[model samples]
Target: MLYIFDLGNVIVDIDFNRVLGAWSDLSRVPLASLKQSFTMGEAFCQHERGELTDEAFAEALCQQMALPLSYEQFSHGWQAIFVGLRPEVIAIMHRLREQGHRVVVLSNTNRLHTTFWPEEYPEIRGAADKIYLSQDLGMRKPEARIYQHVLQAEGFSPDETRFFDDNADNIAGAERLGIPGILVKDKTTVPDYFAKRLC
Candidate 1:
């Protein structure tokens, strides 16, 4: 069987609070308000799927907050906060690769966020036989079409592949396509979950 994993908040740690802090100074809006915007609109999704360029998205956010910072500064600070990997998760990925199952990554992430991933995490880099970034694909998860894209590109029948992701909605999307998924938890527990029959 093959294993497919989602990147953000699954293989990597995402602290939106840091992002909020960086943009707050430029937006002149309270971090809380910015978070509300994130929750209430398509700002984040649009940015992730590459519908909005970084400059445009940052400007829109600045306009929403009525802040004084330049889009470049806001975007730079927003991108700089993430650091390191969950070592245990990395180890699990390596273990899976050693077992000879094909491993792949499908993430709904923009170019800015992905620019450093290949360098920051080389082991996971080696683990994946193929990497599909949403910005590059022009598709995002929790959406059926993106999942179908991976299925088609990788040539894996849904039944032969298992997906691991942190979001329930994305997991459900995989389920809808007849590709089973496991909601990621502590890395230590994932192997037991996988051993029980994946897809």
Candidate 2:
């Protein structure tokens, strides 16, 4: 069976609210207002798709709040969004690969985050047999076309592919395509999940 993993949240932990809270102090804007604009402006999506540079995105965000912020402060807040990978999750990936499974990463990430990916997970550069970055693919999760792209590129049948993602919508999309997918809740239970399915 082929295994596909989602990067953010599933592999790495992220807290947008934490960054937003910090930004709130700098922007003097209500948290609710900032969040509403962020979602409405699709700033997150733009950032993820590489449509907006980090400085440009931050400038937009600050302008939306009518607040002034230097790019450095914005970057500091943005960088605080991601937490590290859980060792158990990393171990699970390694174990699956050691067993000869075709393990790969299918992540939706912006250039800003990816610039620091190697430093964050140095072992991952050559570890995963294959990787699909959404920015480069011009596609993101919950999109059927991206799933098709992944399956086609890997030359794997949908039924034979097992995808693990943290987003329910993405998992649902994969399921609709005949790919078995599980929402990764706890990293420790992954071994059991894989064993039951692959055995």
Candidate 3:
């Protein structure tokens, strides 16, 4: 069996509020205002799809959000979104691999976000046999083609593959391809959930 995991929230604990908090301190924008105004628009999607460079995305974000900060400040606040790594999930994945299952990552993320996780959670990135990044893949999740690309490229059987993600839409997308998806509903319980079954 193959276990495909998502990077954010699933493997690495993340919260956009963390980013907003850091940005609010730097920009003097209230957290509520920042949260309300910040949008994951085309610029963000384009960044994840590797069309927009990090500098371009940051500039676009600052302009759209009316954030009063320099590029350095914006980059610093952006990195704050990552909270920590899921050690339990990583361990379970390793154990599953030891038990003969293939483990891989399929993440919808950008280059700016990439710089942080690897430094913070080296083990999480190394745990996977293959790490598929949206920026590198030129596509993002909930898109049928990305899922199709990974499955076909790996020659994985949909019946034997399980995708773990935190988003409902991503799960639906995988299901459309006949790939079973497990939603990481409660991050705390994810370790136990995998430990019991796959390993």
Candidate 4:
């Protein structure tokens, strides 16, 4: 089986509240106001799709939040979204690779978040045979074309691949292309999934 894993909330734990808190501290914006105003809108989508530059996205996001923050401050708070690494899934992916399955990552993320984590969590860089990011691909999750692009680029058969993501929409997107997707709910989801089936 060829396994395609998602980065956020699956291999790495993330919390948007961290961003709000960090920004609140930096910009003197109330947590409630930040939470209420922050949006995953077109700017965010464009960032993930690699259509918008990091500075542009950050500026747009700041505008949306009505935040007064310098680039350094915004970046600091933006990066705070990452909580920690989840290597439990990585270990399983390595084991699966040993058994002749291909492992790769397909994440809808941008350079803002991507630049920070890989250095901190080396395993994240090595967990998969290939890591596909939307920022580079100009394609994000829940898009049929992105899935098609990865499968075609990797030369993997859709029927033979399994996609694991925390988002149901992304899973559904993969499913539409005949790829069986697993909805990863928590830390144990992937480990538990292969626990009995790892023969």
Best by TM-score: 4
Candidate 2 Cα errors over 4 Å, as ranges: 28-37, 188-192, 195-199
lDDT agreement of model 2 with the native: 0.78
Better of 3 and 4 by lDDT: 4
Candidate 3 Cα misplacement greater than 4 A, ranges: none
RMSD of 1: 2.9
Give one digit per residue, the lDDT tens place, for model 1 in 139-168: 798899999988888788999998999888
| Residue 117 lDDT (model 1) | 70
Between candidates 2 and 4, name the one with more favorable TM-score. Answer: 4
List model 2 lDDT by residue over 1-199, tens digit each: 6889888777777778887877778767787886776653577677766677878887877787665678877777777778777665677778778888888999978777776766878766555788898778877777899999989888899988999888888899899999999897765556667566543
lDDT of 4 by residue, 1-199 (tens): 7899999899999998998999999999899999899888999999999999989988998998899999899999989988898877888888888999889999999998888988977897776899999999988999899999999988889998999999999999999999999999988898889889887
Output the TM-score of candidate 1: 0.85
Which residue pairs clash within candidate 4? none
Winning model by lDDT: 4
lDDT per residue (tens digit) for residues 154-187 in model 3: 8888998989999999999999999999888877
Between candidates 2 and 3, the one scoring higher on lDDT is: 3
Descending-lDDT candidate ranking? 4, 3, 2, 1
